[model samples]
Target: MDKNNLTPVEKNKSPLILSIVVGIVLILFLAGGLAYAFSTNLITMPFNKAIELLVPEISATANPDSSSIVTITNPNSTGTIYYTIDGSDPLTNSLKYETPITINSTTTLKATVIDEKDNKSDISTQQFTIMEKTVEKAVETVVPENSSSIIIPEEYQGTWHSIKATGTYNFSGNTYTYSSGGNVHSGTIGKIEPYGNSSTILVFYPIEVNHGFTVDPGEKGDGMIKIDGTTYAVENSDVFD
Candidate 1:
């Protein structure tokens, strides 16, 4: 066709068609540029690295008697710590560590940490053994000649009340009677020795009854410490109470 020979409709459609083709080519050129940049490592995209959680730490302090105070700590300080005392593996639903655990006997403590991202850490474990203190018979004085009873020292004798438990302990001669919790436990004072400043260690041999203390008496006797000549505390019990 010759110039200025086209109709009015064709004249208007020419610019619109040319604009659409130009837009398509520009889009293709931009896409090719982006592909080349990525292929040549010119521009980089943002990346997120995986986060790791830290394991917890277990520590313990053994008391003079057969007991220990166990403490658990985490380095992150932002996550929750779960633990177990029965040597089992710890999980999220296990006992949440909030305070120091008091272990009276031998135990294996296990702990782990869980962060906000649900990342779990390796388990930390510690074993605590509460060894019983032994005293020889010849070192202490025995009473009643043939009987297997030890003399109750004058300071620890007589009726005394426990500051911790709602009980009364009566010591007379070589026998002792402990009354508490709607029951009475009578036994012989098997051993007595001097403890820390103004304190004494007393062991009771229960007579067909279990002593109401942390460690139940077996073949061995139940031990108690008289603190400062006023308060009586059992094994694993807090000091001076």
Candidate 2:
């Protein structure tokens, strides 16, 4: 058809339709750009603040002669801090962080904060390097020939159960009786020496050894080490129930 033959409505219709298509295309381009920006963190929504909590901060104070003290802090003070010293991820059921942790050895500590709203923060990790302290070996004092036995400490003069070994030890004064595997062995405490800051080494001298027993008779310098006032290490195994 000839250009001049076309009606005015037809002439206006093409231009109006072209303008509508151009406007729609521009709007779709803008929407696509905005979606990409939001997804890529180029732009963050205001509501995202309510979804994620802030991360916690972990720090440590070093002690050259002893252990390192670790502290965990969060910006939001209303939350409870949970931490792990075994290099594991922190969970709600993990060790609750109340007081500062005393790390005796080198450890990797991880911590997280859980707010009142149950919002958990990202894990914060820190590696603590502890200075190794040389532990002095306990010195043995020669016992007099006339001395049959030494008085056992009052704290250690009781019946104690073994945690790892299948035995029960009863201590009364300087005498000790160990019963295991249907066999009984009696011994006397020869000497007591300080092994460490919180440990004592008790040297034993067996008075009667059961020939049927296959275990140690607590003689020949084999002794028990009291650790932390509650546990005893006998023959390199923890003997505390």
Candidate 3:
């Protein structure tokens, strides 16, 4: 075969060699670029988002029956909760949550949490209403059908007003009369029984007209009758004649 007229096999070999060189160079350039990116943290997109400490959450609620307790909580198990009243922000020096707090009136409560990794959570806040229990009583006329000289407590002799609505109760000599909601109710103290240390229940009876009135058995409490979970304030009338 003449050198000027290269054989088909030789020409093919030359082309294959050139292609291999080009591929190797391209691979080397790509490798260098990858190395540069890693050194400068440019390709660290995935690693930059490593798991981070989470912030804490807060919860709060009020006690419905009494103005004595309000509950506050941090659901995150990895952190401690701090709190403040007076509409102030809580700090590390704030009161640490250990037990339920007592709230007697309207108050602004704020709280914060700090995780184990020192990550601080957003401040949480709540407005708590400690409502005063308004005395509730029914309107009725006092008619003592049953007579017993069971002396009632001196404190029981008084005029009471309904805290929730327009009502009045006048008590004298084991008898109390009430008028409410265009209705009237009257009852005589049949029996006085001790409830708690400072509470007593006065069993009452209706006379004259029944009017389908109901004297709840659960109406026994401290100088007040508990009707429908409400306490009627019974006190000496400011305008007793």
Tell me the tens digit of each residue's lDDT in model 2 across 95-196.
Answer: 999888888888888999987778899999888777776867756665543355556655555665565456677878777787879999776555454433
Each prediction's TM-score versus the true structure:
0.39, 0.36, 0.33
User: lDDT of all predictions, in order shown?
Assistant: 0.68, 0.68, 0.63
On TM-score, who's better, 1 or 2?
1
167-226 per-residue lDDT for model 3 (tens digits) = 876668866687888888776655443332323333444344433222332443444554
Candidate 1, residues 1-241, lDDT tens digits: the string is 9758999998899899999999999999999999898778776555423356789988888776769888898888578999998999998889999999889987888999987767788999888877866774435443433355446555445665566667767777777777889899676654443332323244443434433222112222234444334455443434434
lDDT of 1 at 10: 84
Instruction: Provide the global lDDT of candidate 3 against the true structure.
Output: 0.63
TM-score, structure 1 vs. true: 0.39
* Regions more than 4 Å wrong, model 3: 1-68, 133-241
Question: Can you give the lDDT of residue 77 in candidate 3?
Answer: 63
Distance from true position, residue 108, model 3, in Å? 0.7
Residue 161, candidate 2: C-alpha displacement in angstroms: 50
In candidate 1, clashing pairs total 0
**RMSD (CA, Å), each prediction:** 16.0, 15.7, 15.2
Angstrom error at residue 18, model 1: 21
Per-candidate clashes, comma-separated: 0, 0, 11
